[model samples]
Structures are given as structure tokens and as C-alpha cells.
Target: MDTTKIEKNFKKLTSSNKIFESVLMIGNASGDFNFTREYKRDIDTPMLMASTTKLLTTTCIYALVQEGKLNLKDELSNYLSKEEISGLHVFKGKEYTFELTIEHLLSQTSGLPDFYLTGTKPVFSKVKDRDFSYSFEEELEWIKHMKARFIPGTKRKAYYSDVNFDLLGKIIEAANASTLQEAYEKYIFSPLNLKHTYLANTESDFIPHTYYKDQRLYRPLFIRSCYASGGGVTTARELMIFIKAFWKGELFDKTFFSKQAQSNPLQMSFYPIHYMGGYMKITASYPFGKKYTLVGHSGSTGAFAFYCLEKDLFIVGDVSQIASPSTGVRLAMRTVLAAE
Candidate 1:
């Protein structure tokens, strides 16, 4: 563990822009190189995990699978009524709504257009003010108004849809007869004793502000509607704990974990960030001819939690810049290289 080198890399990343506050935590199974450092934000402040929330959502889903409560291959209609998810994934000239499966949603293969970015005009464009937020129910209504990207299960095709996980959130709730937040606490946070990690159910929660361009803003209250998809909040220390347990099979068996990562990946809207099932993977070669593969997930608000399988290392933190989503990955790479 090279604290000097890791801090050096963190400093470089924060210097890039005013919006780029950060907290970085890196550790290995041996507890070497384990430290938490923050820039502009306190080390204990809880920040939005953004899309990294999916990692938690998927973990809960898989736990249910392990307990025989759910099956990945189960159809979406099995749990959701047609009215609840109605018109959400209509294709060229046909409706494949019920045909969509849990596996499709988990792997982003459902062909559901991303309600945020995939529309002919993105949903964000509808936001007259950047301060606006939306509820998950409202997001589903908006999704019902959009068209599907393709027929479900088309070979070599996947679209990153927040809708998929939103529906999965609903499924988790339906399956458990409880709220998504409670499900998370029972299945993930509680067992792991993660006192700080939780779904941000409202904008008034004590979450740190994230940077979007030049604006400093707290995530919208409505964004909490997407809690199952990207509405998690956690400190750097807890984020590392979750990611390490996630990849090391602490939440479930290793065979199920492997199944979660075995799907074909789709490039996220960021560099070096790829998605398979509910997790993200980063594959890169450091300058010294060393290649690293790290798996977990990152948030668009520059939050990241990933573990390097080859090195048994965990990197968790945020660059806190919406525009600098790649900063976390860059820091992870540099940190790994420096540790060597």
C-alpha cells in the first residue's frame, strides 16, 4: 500500500475542476492499502451512488434467487401486471411487454429504451429546470410514453435502460411485500452491518451535493423514485466494504456471482465502464505492462465501487463531477499501478 502515491493521484484528480470533490478508498483482502481520503467533502458524508445502486438492487435480487424466492429467467409479467408496466417496451409493430424476463432486465437485454437518454428527445430535455426531480412512478409514466429500442432478446443487442431496473425495483417490492429500501436493508445492508449505506428516499436526506458542469446541486427528491436503480447513498468506507463483499461472494455464493457477471457486456455512457447484469467492469493495462480487471459498479455522480479480481483489491470513491465520470476509473488504475 502506497499512501503517498495514492494521495498524489487523488490530488491530481481533484485539481481538474471545482465540481470535482472526491473521497477515495482502496483496500485488499489482506487489509493492506486500506485508507479513506476526501476532497471538498467529509470522509463520512453520504453521497449519491447514482447507477451504482443497481449493484445493490441486483444483489438483493440474487439473494432472493439463492433462497428460491425468485428466478432470473422468470417473466416480468409474472410479477407485474400489464397495467403497471403497460406500453413500456412496445417494438416496431408489436408489444413484447410480458415477454420481457428478469434476465433481460438484469442484463440490459430487454431492449427497453432508456427513459433518460434513449428517447428521440431525452427525458432530461423535458426538465425546464436542472433542479427538478422525478418519482419512479412518474418515470414509469414517462417510459410508457416512449417506444422500445428493439425486440427483446435480439442477438448481440442491449440497451442500458434505467426503466429495466425501475421495474426490477417494483419486482423486488412485489416479491417481498415490502418497500425497496427495506428489502435492501434486510438483504444487503443489515447482513453486512453497513450502518451508513441506504437508499435515499428523499432529497432532504443528508446527502452531499454533486457537481453538474459549474452548478453544485443536491440530487432531486424525485430521483429517489429511482432508488432501486441509482438512488443509493454511502460513505467511502462503507462503499468499499460493499464492493469487496459483492465481488468476493459475501452476499451470495460464488457460482451465482459468476452467473451475474457472465452476461455479454454493453459499454456504458462512460469510457472504460462496461455493464453486465447489474455490475460494471473495468479492464485496463497499467503503464508497466500489468493488466487489471475490476468488477462492481459506478455512479454517474462520479461515485465508484469496484474490486480487482486479479489483485484482490477494492477501490471505492467518487470524483463528484458529472462531467468527469471517468475520473474514478482513472484514479483506480493509477492507484493499482502505484501500489505495485
Candidate 2:
């Protein structure tokens, strides 16, 4: 592949957006055909992954399932106490808390409200003004007062909620008897030899500041509080290795990919994107309006890790801008089209 066009396009993109310190990497499944481009940041620079961290949580959940410690059909009540989950999903005055299952959360069909974006007191808007930490218990408390969108397992229903993955993180701890960070280290980082990928757990953990337009935001407490839903930091190189392994079945059964691929359209805010088993999917239309599927996830902080099934290529990178979450996806699409 002649990379002249790829390099030129990347340079143009960075030049036009001066606040964009970015990295773009492309590789094949077999570890060959590698290409990387950086603007003001190298492949080794760690960046906040935001919601792209959900893919890592999904990997650990699959590992537990393979080990017979978890099952998709298992009820949420199995792992969480009644007091913790009660009143969580009360739609139309019908309590459907116990009706939720591991599959529901993984597929984002639990009808649960998003604590970060929803509710009268949404944390998303407040985070821009101030930095603070909130525990899982606090997040759950916020969800309890919010209204659920639909009933669990409703046909053709899917809502993006950080609370879903946060709950899964708790279930993983209950089933595996280990911390979510430790589980990630064992099932993903250690196995893939990813030295720079980790869940941001403390102030000691270094987290790269992200941009919301021209302003730089460094909310370490907010990032740490996101936990499994979003709190993750990694370099472009390490993220490329992990995403390739995920699609190549190096960590868990690749067969699960088929089941997870039965995606449902998310809310209107996430138009043209679908929710799969803990990941995002977009059928991107390149030049001449030709469409192809890109499987994986993008984060609110302009981070992305995706695999183009039609092209048989893995694309991973970060745009380092919070105001434009879709920038990474557009960049990945352009990179794939440019490589051809």
C-alpha cells in the first residue's frame, strides 16, 4: 500500500485543527502491513480512551463466561444485592429490575437510563465546570431516580448507558472474586503483552488531558470515577495490539462475535451507529457512496479502536478532542479509504 496519500491527508487534518494532537495506526490481523502516523504525539503517548474502555470490559466478561463463572442468561440479581438493583428499572410503574440479564446489559437493551447523560442532574454537563469523583453506588443512586426508556428485552430497543457497563464491572468482580482492574490485567493486558493499557484507578495513574475545542480538560477524578464504563488509558500502539487480538480471537472465543453482531440501533443522538455486545458498529459510506461495516467502538474523548471487516484491517487512534467524538470515526473512515 502506497502511504503517501495517507500521510498527506493526516498532515492536512492536523494542520487544520491545531488543538488536535493525534495518532493513527493501521495493521492486519497477522501483525503485518503496519502503518502509523502521529501529529504532536507519538505511538507511545498515553491517551484517555473514554467509552472505548467498554470493549476491554466486554473481553473480560467473555473470559469469565468461557471459564464457566458467568452466563449470559444469568439474572442481574444473581450478582447484585436486591437493595442495590431494586427500583432501577421501573417503567410505567412496573418493576422490571429482576428481569434484567447479563445479555441485556451487554447488548444495551436493559432500558436503563444513562447516569452520565440522563437524569435532571447529569454528570456530563457538570464535569465541564468542575472535577469530582463519584462511586458506583452514587451512580446507581442517580439511575434509580431516572425513568427507564423501555422494558428490558423490548424488541428493537437499545439505549446507550454507562450504567450498564458499570454494573457489568461489578458482576465481574462478584463472579471472579477480583478487582475489575486485575481482571483486565489478567485476561487482556497480560495475555496480549499490552504494557501501556490500564484502567485509571488513582491520582497516581497518569491520564492525558483531552480537548473540548480550544480548552484543555484534565479531570482526573472524573476519569477515575468512570471505572469500567470509560476510565481507561492507553497508547496507540498498545490499543492496536489489543483490538487486533479482540477481533482475531486471541483473548476469547471468536464465535461470540457472531452473537454480538446482532446489533440494535441506538438513540437518535447516536444515529448511523448500532450497539452490539458492548461495542459500537457503523456502516460507513466512503467515496461514491459505497458502504462497508466497521466493528468496534469510539470514545467521547475522540478515541477510537475499530476493525474494518470488509477491508480486513484494524484501525486504532485518538483525536484528543472531547467536543467532537465522531472525529475519530471520520478519521478512521478516511484512513481506510485513503489506503486503498
Candidate 3:
């Protein structure tokens, strides 16, 4: 595919006003595209991937399932203590916490309140250093304080909860008998040959800094404890490789992938686009009224990766701006449309 128009549109995207850096990359099925341009940072720079880390965690879980080590229908009670999950899903005077399964967590159908945004609206603020740190135990205590939004497996309502993946992180460690970082390295990073992906357990100057409303955020403490959920940091190229593997079902069985694709009823998100099982399905009308649909995922930290099946196109990159996270999705759409 000719990328001249994509490159031109990327130029305009980076030219727009922003407080932090941006990156963009586009490729095809053979994975031949490695071209990159930076606005204020280098192509090698690594940045926080935010919720895109969910894709990694989910992929790892599926790998375990394919190995016959675990099943999606398995209950959380089998892996976690009843006391640990008590009052987690109190719906209509009934506590359905232990009934939650790995499937509910992966599809965001657990009805569990988000540990991060339970009561507060998103705010763009300034930061200087690593702000705070909390253990997974502490996060669970917080979740217990919050009320459940609905019963588990409601089918009509899916609430995106960090706690869901945080629990999954624990499950991964339990199943692998190792830390989430180690498990990822063994099953994913190493096998995929991803050179620049890691969980940011501590503040590092090497990781690209992010800004919200002109004020920098000290990498949150939760980033470390939430490694399987949203603590990962990576580059555009590495993310694209993962996306390609995801769509191609390289690490998991095709039947498992088919199950996930068919289980979008809970409505985890729209983002002005549709998403399921950590993947977004892009659909929109371009100039002259042509429409398209692509599948991939985006991070709230202005990161995006997607594959346009019809065009055999794969695009991945980030704006590295938290204040306008939606900017990354818009840029991806613009780039995809420009290719037409």
C-alpha cells in the first residue's frame, strides 16, 4: 500500500498544538513497515501503554487456556479466597462476587466498579515525581468500599474495571507460579522477540514522560501494582507486532479467538467506535461516503494499534498526550482514511 497520504496526514497531525510528543507507524500483513517519524522524541522512545496492557494480559490468559492449564469458565473462587472477594458484587441485596469467572473479567462483564474512576471524573493535572504507590491488597480494599454497579454476567451492561484485570494478574501469577512480569517475558515478550516492552515498576528517565493539561503526571503507584492491567510501557513497533499476533491468533487457539470475537454483548465501550475483548472494531465513513472496519486496541494515554483486514493494513503509534487521549484514535482514523 502507498503510504504517501498517510505520511502527509501524520505531518499535519503532529503539527497541531500539544504539550508532549507524538509518534505514528503504519504497516501491512507481512510486517514490512518500520518507518517512523518523531515530533519531539525518538522512534525508540518507550511510553506508558495504559489500558492496552489489557491485551497482553488477556493474550497470556488465552495462551494458558490453549495449553489446557485453565478454562475461561473457571470461577474466581477457585483461585482466590472467599474473604478476599466478599462484598465485591453485592447486587440487589445478593452477593454474587464468587460467581465471577475469568470470562467475565476478560470481557469486562463483571459489573465491578473501576478501582481508578469509581467516583471521580477524569482530570488533567500537573505532576513532578512518582505520586503514590499502593499494593494490590490495598486496591482490593478500595474495591470492597465501592458498590457493584450490577450483577455479574448481566449481558446488557459491561463496566470496564481495572480491578478485574488486577485480579487476572494475580490469577496469571497463580497459574504460572511466577510474577506477572516474568510470566509475560516467558510467554510473550521473549517468544515475540519484543525488545522494548516491560512493566514500569519504578520511575525511569528512559520512559517517555506524559502530560495532562500541560502538567506532567508522576507515574502513578498503581502502574507498578497494576502491571497486568495498565502498567506496561512499550514502543509503537512492539505494539504493532502484538496486534498482528492477536488478530492472527498466533499465541492462542483459533477456536478460543472465535469465542472472544462472538462475546461482545456486554458492551464494554464505544469510544465513538466499538470494542470487545480488549480490541476495538473501527467503523466509519470517509470522504465520498466509503466506510471501513478494522480491529485492534487503543490506550487512554494516546496510544493506538489497529489492523484493517480489507486493506491488509496495520497501524500503531501514540501521541503521548494524556489530556486529549482521544486524539490518538482520531489520528488512526485519519491515517486509515488517507490510505484510501
Cα lDDT listed for each candidate = 0.77, 0.90, 0.74
Q: For model 1, how many clashes?
A: 0
Superposed model 2: Cα runs more than 4 Å off? none
TM-score result, candidate 2? 0.96
Off by over 4 Å in 1: 3-5, 125-128, 202-204, 260-263, 286-288
lDDT of 3 by residue, 38-145 (tens): 787765678788878888888888888877777889999888888887877877788888899988887788888875643442212212323556788877777777
Q: Output the TM-score of candidate 3.
A: 0.89
lDDT of 1 at 37: 75
lDDT of 1 by residue, 41-150 (tens): 77577788888899999988888888888998899999988777777778887889889999899888888877765667675444323555677667777777787778
Please tell me which predicted candidate would have the highest TM-score against the true structure. 2
lDDT of 2 by residue, 187-282 (tens): 998998888889999878997898878888999999999998999999999999899889999999989887754789999988878988888888
- Name the 10 consecutive residues with the lowest summed lDDT in model 3: 121-130
Question: What is residue 246's positional error in candidate 1, in angstroms?
Answer: 1.4
Residue pairs of candidate 3 with colliding backbone atoms: 127-216
